[model samples]
Target: MENPTFSIQDIPPTLLCYAVAELDFSTLSPNLTNSTLQSLKSCGANQLAGLLSSFTTITSETLVSLGSLAVGLSPSVLENINGSILKENLQSLSTINNWSATQASIIVSKCKVQSDKQINADTLKQLGSLVIGVQSAEIKTLKSDDILSLANNSILTGYMEKAPIVLKKQFVQGIIQATSKTKKTIFQVVPAELASEIPVSNLLDSNLNVSEINQMKWTSSQVLPITNQAQCKSYFTRVGQANIDLLPQGSPKRNTLLSNAKSCLNINSNIITKDNLVILGSLVCDLTDKEIISSDSYVLDALKICSSFTDSQKVAIVTKLKAQYGAPSKWTLSNMKQIGSLSSALDSEIMKTINKSVMIKFFPGLLSVLRVQHKTTFTSVITQLKNSSRIAARDSLTCEEKLTTDSITKQMDLIVARYSAAQLNICTSNETLLNNLNILGSLAFDDDQLKVFKGILDMRLPGGVPNEYLIQLGNIARVYSEKEIRSWNITSVDTLATLIQSASWQSNDSKINEMVYRYLQLNSPNATFDGTLLTVLAPYICSLNQTLIQNITSGALRNSSQSLEVSTCNQNIKNILFDKMKLGYSSVNSTSNAYFQIMSPVIGGARFSDLINFGKGFPEMDLSTFTTLNPNEVKTLSVENIKDLLGSNVLDINTISSSSVLQVWVASKTQMEVNSLGVNATAGIKSPVPNGVTSGVGVPHCTLYLLLVCIMASLLYMDNDFL
Candidate 1:
């Protein structure tokens, strides 16, 4: 029941062939002895064919070798051969010299051929004997060589001549290598449905007549992948301008042909004229920016000569030019002139490509030209110039040239006062102050600007301080108190000196005096008296009290002898006190009650010795130097001074109420008592009379309490006339 096994090498060729043909091939080993394979030639062709048919998995090479051997057997073997084996060995079909036309027809009908592989020429010649044997579709599937071979064979030509349109297109594509005469014949036979589908490159190989080239209408889908520059040149030459123009837009062939056209033709050639280029304009548009820019000079010249462009086409050209050159700095003068010549619209658009510096430098001249040439749009041009100029100015300021005096002034001139404090702060600088002097005079500064201005002033300039700059600093000082100024590092001494030197202190006395006070306060820790400075500051010393004066002079003179130039210092001191006393008394009528109230405590503390010392410095006056002995001065207490003392105490009501001085005054008031005994001038006396006491007795004593109250009240009112 089991199949018998034999060593494949031991089997005889005739016996193996017989067994292979009779048994299920699935049961047989594919391995065969070389002797057995060589002896296959002795087997009958019918048996060999049957053996090939029995094996489903035989290699095509094995089938082919066996089929070749089968040729030595019966011719009838070819007729009964498996179609798969026949198709695999179709190339071998031509080698079968004894094959009949009927056998050829049978093989062609039975086999399923590969579509991609070219059929042998000998096979086509053999198949041509009976064209009806081949499927119409199969005929079209033939490669170029097979189709050309069939084209030459008169027998098969009849069937191919009237093939269906799809088959006709394939047939036309296949015979690309056919002889000119044969290709011409084939072209002449091409059906109308295939007219557009045929590659124009194919027709050129056949020396297609000019009329034929013109007549061929390429569809939009036509693809000609040829890269032969000469062939492309020749095709375009034969087709002429009109027919070449008819090529599909953006088609590969159109690009290939035009690129070749430029290289082939000279600029002066008739084919390269403006009219021809105008016809080929669409092809120019299809070229990439790189391609057009890199194209041959003749091509570019041809484009230049062609002037029949629409506005949109010019725009497209300019757009491409922009892409090619990128920024305007990449363009040369010649490039600018050439691009400018394209159209006024493009010339105007090119302005966008220029660097801001270039525009600002050259715009005025260009604007003049534009005003004449593009008069209607001059205003818009001006507006654009202004906008670009503003950016250029800002960027220039941000560069190394930013803080130059001229640059700062130039930028300031353009500002419309609309910028925020931070934006305006960009312009605050020592250079700005030194150059513009009054830039910050009216400008409102926020906290940050104030800080920046302070820094700007703190920097030492070329000169000590500009004469006119003091006015500007006065505005700043008015806003910044001494504390704020110190925080910003703007030394109050320098500011005060600058203000004094410029005479700005005359109009801004209160601010200047405050600066002096602040400067004095700042130096208090290490203060020393400077006799020379004190002499110059004498008249202006009215604002400061003796205590502050003493502190400042003490510090200024700390290193110097206290007796240095006593004579001159004495005169200066005398003048200072006179000025103080004179101004204080003269200004009291107009001075605020609050001013007097503020000074009231200082006046109340003065003593007779102090009055003598002050009065000695102002001996020219009629003022009296009074102490506890001057009952006359006590009688001179004015209602105004007493009221101001009360008001001054009222402002600090809590401290005054709890003060020891008020306790003493109140205690003295409660202790005072008075007793009186009186007799009429008629000399009547009481019933009980004292010995030395007459009819009437009255008591009034110079008590310490009374004297104390009187002295305290007068002290509160000071030598009230002596401010």
Candidate 2:
């Protein structure tokens, strides 16, 4: 056994087994190579059993020498290993994340036996990921002091991340008890990972010092557990202004916090004062319709920007303003400026009443927040204003001054914004407007408008639309007929990328696919699609036929940077992409946290069984993807998963209901559990979708359309109505 030239490969299996049995454990341990371990594993189970039997006592060194071969060891053999040996070697042992539950449990049991059945910080740290194998009852037995001692350590946090809901609750209860007595609050003592586990009851502690709470950093997940009227009141009162200011505008946390705060505060608008409104700040957005109507105009004026007001709330404020000022027609420029962003709430009728001077002054702020329907009306108002001014100026100015390039450009913008397909005759007759037809890209044309606009564009670019003109067309390119798009000479991937990325095709699948197909056939006819090209074409990749999608290389899919956009693709496309993704990101355990991190964007396409395989990484799924999950599949998610998921949005009811999967999942939980999950049992549910918007396959299509138009308008005509 001590031969200097000896190699495991040189020895016969039978002889090597006997030699391994006879060798000193310490001497052989250090010399064991991965090759030597594989050779040992290949020796057949019976032979290895004979070899293991020869050792009277197995030490940590002996197990370390086994390396991956430990995975091959039977439970009976593992159980026979001494607890002291297991305890000392737990750190090394736990590195193998693929261990079977039975195998890991045996290690935990042996470690506990050595430490008097109580898991302390040192032992817990040593267990590493094997803590996932620790049963719910064992987790319940975790002492408060032990958890507190490891407050700064990641061991408990790591365990809570992957542990089942039932186990996490038990562990969280221990944490609640552990932090209750300390001068520091739970926010001060608990690791951020375990922050979501704290219940609303614990969070609503009346004894909490506001100054102390304000000083601590709060994550959206940490605040998500406060859902009900009682919790919102207690939580908001405790959180202080500093922490509240930390929430981002239009975020789910801020929305839900204000919603619940308004309900709980139950402010009386009839008697509310200016100072009270100032103190309420963003919470004023939550004031009921009746309350808004009753509130004094001067007091309402004290409030500034309302980042996200519901359509009904906006109407109520407008109604109150009209009552105070008579009608918008009678209101002066001073009145329009006084209302600030409330100007966005004004209806078409009210807008028509507004004179040219007041609207020009107010348009900047109003344009940013105008509702979709109001945009068309506002465009007509601009047209009327422009026409009246032109008539007055025409009598005083010569044709040379009236038809100047700047004046014609301004007129082109007005016509594009105001004219319908029938009214487009004026533009067709004007050579100057036809030359600046790229301005048409600022608006989304219907089929009739597209026909008229296309005729004008064809007349302007009779040589056939080249790459430069196509790029300038912006979203207008999306409306081109398939024959017109296919006729374009696409010479560079950059040109294709720019047009595809810039243009947002609403439901024009055929047109988008035509553009994509033409680009592939012309620019990349023989080339294998790389990450750069794949990402560039991501917007319309779903339109690719099955064969083309399946042909996309695994390496390209792994390296592609358009995962967020790709996640929005149809199920068939995603399924194909995910197949290639799996090949690129192969894992021994597909459910591990590492796998989830690499595969999260496309993982939504995974089968229900594969999705349920997720361990600690379950919460990493994005909200949009999380919503598409089967309700029954969501029901099977671990409690810790649900908490972490809900906690991501800070337990906002509106946020939760936005995902029907979460709504159904929340409905199945007990009232007590629901409160613990972060929403109140009594809070009313509201649609997450805004007014005059529709979603397709969990995506907010109308919202996206408006966003694209705004972007295009900003790039083309900075002062267009779409803005």
Writing each residue's lDDT as its tens digit, candidate 2 over 1-723 gives: 448787556777556654543332224443454335555666655344324432334657667767655655544356568988888877778775555554666677667777764556666666776766565566566677777776666654665566645556667677778877776667677666665576667776735554444434344345545344444444454433433435655676667766655555675345555544555555665566666776666545643445445567767888888887778777777887777766645555556566755654555445434424345434543554344444443323233232235543444433332345545544344465355545555544455656766677777778888676777676667667788888887665567766776655653266766766677778664444655567666556766667677778876665454553454466777677777778776632465443554566666566555665664434345455567655666665655665554344443444555566666766666555556666544322333565656645433344554887546644665444356
Please state the error at residue 518 of candidate 1 in Å.
14
Query: Each prediction's TM-score against the native?
Result: 0.19, 0.55
Give per-residue lDDT, candidate 2, residue 379: 50
Per-residue lDDT of model 1, residues 232-350, tens digit only:
44444433334434555555666666665565444333234453454345455444444444444334433442222444555555565666556665666555545442323244345
Give the least accurate 10-residue stretch of model 1, judged by summed lDDT. 672-681
Query: Compared to the true structure, candidate 2 yields what TM-score?
Result: 0.55
Model 2: lowest-lDDT 10 consecutive positions? 395-404
RMSD of each: 56.1, 21.2
Residue 260 CA error for candidate 1 (Å)?
99
Candidate 2, residue 299: the lDDT equals 48
- In angstroms, the error of model 1 at 284 is 88
In model 1, the runs with Cα more than 4 Å from the true position are: 1-421, 427-432, 439-448, 457-472, 475-548, 551-605, 608-723
On lDDT, the candidate that comes out on top is 2
